[model samples]
Target: MIPDPTVRLIGWAVTRTAEAIVDRAADRIATKMKTCIVMTVRHRAVAALPKRGRV
Candidate 1:
């Protein structure tokens, strides 16, 4: 099964990959959406601020 946009966009591949390997797809998606904001901020990816504002 393919991951959704949320998973890919978040780019937390290690966590996502572990989840996938464990068949935790929904958990992976939710974790991605949840963590993306924090990770982007940590990485200084301000582009997410605009996207978050739009959302």
Candidate 2:
């Protein structure tokens, strides 16, 4: 399903914030582990794209 612009934007912010937290936590645990966390953020940002394209 596709989210509206507002919804998608909100989701984008939420997802980004969550990813940042996760990435920071990972860095705290192990500095070298940040690459995986960053990759995960990239994956999620891509996944959040509306399947039907933008409104």
Candidate 3:
């Protein structure tokens, strides 16, 4: 049986909204992970540098 036009439109809108929300959340997570990785790398590199003073 075919559903009402209004109901179908609402369902489609909800689906699209959910997808957009998910996409935004994933992007945020990826950005945070990237920042963490970069920070860790920088910290390790700094630690590896030779200390000043004392020959």
Q: Pick the TM-score winner.
A: 3
Per-residue lDDT of model 1, residues 1-55, tens digit only: 6579777766787777877777777778889988997886777866545554453
Estimate the overall C-alpha local distance difference test score of candidate 3: 0.97
Across 1-55, the per-residue lDDT of candidate 3 in tens digits comes to 6679989999999999999999999999999999999999999999999989977
Backbone atom clashes (below 3 Å) for every candidate? 0, 0, 0
TM-score of each: 0.27, 0.49, 0.82
Candidate 2 residues 1-55, lDDT tens each?
Answer: 5669988899999999999999998777785567778989999999999788578
Rank by lDDT (best first): 3, 2, 1
Identify the runs in model 1 with alpha carbons over 4 angstroms from their true place: 1-23, 41-55
Worst 10 residues of 1 by lDDT: 46-55
Q: How close is candidate 1 to the true structure, as a TM-score?
A: 0.27
Q: What local distance difference test score does each model get?
A: 0.75, 0.88, 0.97
The candidate 3 region of ten consecutive residues with least summed lDDT is 1-10
TM-score of 3: 0.82
Alpha-carbon shift of residue 52 in model 2 (angstroms)? 74
